[model samples]
Target: MSGNSAERAGELEVVLVKAGRTKIRYRSELLLDDGNHVAVRAPWAGEGVRDFGFVRFEPGDVFTEHYWRDRWYAVKEVRAGDGTLKGWYCDVTRPAVRDGAELVVEDLDLDLWRSADGTEVLRLDEDEFAESGLAERDPEGATAAVAALDELEKQARAEGGLTALLA
Candidate 1:
């Protein structure tokens, strides 16, 4: 989290938090950090193939993730090891916080996914979001999370979809 440009290129520890606890954390190569937006690249952190029926995340898959301090979501561009485009996996979360070498993001439990071909745009994990009782506990955060999910879905269905947002 240095202001110096030359110090930007290095390893960044990504901490994903859920329910006031750390969910998952991994190291990623910090590609860009322009104050508001932070981008990092990392290989799939899961141990085995995760088949979601729509997409499979296995070894040799890379994820280029984008997080914003001013936004309530994070977008991840998934690609195969051979450089084939897969799709985008987006998470509805609280605005990201950069603490020294650690980038912390809180999972709001809502998610959206868009296929690379733009043939399928899915809203995922709404049940989990509701079950989390965010609305009862934190109404404002719950509202923001829903709004973020809506905005992401709209962008995913737009003409350029996620490509336009990533670009």
Candidate 2:
């Protein structure tokens, strides 16, 4: 559970869904699956370097992603090919669902980013979240998404930050 030495259960197809459509689907090495929480390792799924000023996700970046079946968020720890810690990327989403070899998660358009040194903790896509009209369409879901984002941001700012949570 702490390392990648755990039994490898082949691969899992991670499906990111938004607005009732699949936004991205990538295969990841299933590292840990404890019924409630699941962890996987995968390379950057983006085509090229996606520089966002704060961070860049390139082809050689590796992502150790964690998803919870009960939590409304997913946390991904990004590292370079040489094993340099980049940071953590969190997605506010509905609880993940596992069906056979597929893991499905619905994005709520809210995300959080934390720098490796913990100097930068950014709450992103609030405007997109608001403009998504999820509040009007699904009030409960919207509320949950907002709450999840807040929780993640708070955790990312804490003393040990996401490191403690992920550990």
Candidate 3:
């Protein structure tokens, strides 16, 4: 689903992975294109750390570049404990300028997957995910999370097209 700016802002669910010595902890704060509010911070770090949530890499762990924005942003690829290559953790770049930043809504989507049966969606809903566990690579969550995503889409559209959130 697209849009969902303010909702995304309120719906922000961060999964903090405390990396071991070799593993690097990457704390990603995905915002819904909030004007001048889209920022990425360091793990346990307060105040002006670069928006790109880059952490020290641990041995045997791989962080690859995925989606790129302009000549700067590059989405980080995170590999979970299950050997699954998950999507970006934090991607930082100059957001697309819509109406000179007013009425601009950048889609902030945190995608999770569901099982082939689809019943799994309900088990790992948003709140559960917020407390239970993290979303695997390309894998859908329980019904509730999926429902929230659906609602988020509707809400996103109602806000002001896609650019409104960014604005």
Q: After superposition, how far is residue 56 of candidate 2 from its true place, in Å?
A: 0.3
Q: What is the TM-score of each candidate against the true structure?
A: 0.94, 0.93, 0.21
For model 3, what is the alpha-carbon lDDT of residue 37?
40
CA RMSD (A), model 3: 15.8
Q: Per-residue lDDT for 30-93 in model 2, tens only?
A: 9888999999999999889999999999999999999999999999999999999999999999
Give the higher-TM-score candidate: 2 or 3. Answer: 2
List the candidates ranked by lDDT, beginning with the highest: 1, 2, 3
Cα deviation at 127, candidate 1, in Å, is 0.4
How does candidate 2 fare on TM-score? 0.93
- The number of clashing residue pairs in model 2 is 0
RMSD of each: 2.5, 4.3, 15.8
Residues 1-167, model 3: lDDT tens digits: 23355245432222222111211223334433344343332233223332322232333434332221221122334443344543233322223232321222122233332222222221112354444343453134334335545543443335342123223
* Evaluation by lDDT, superior candidate among 1 and 2: 1
Clashes of each: 0, 0, 22
Off by over 4 Å in 2: 1-9
The deviation in Å at residue 93 for candidate 2 is 0.5
lDDT, each prediction? 0.92, 0.92, 0.32
lDDT winner? 1
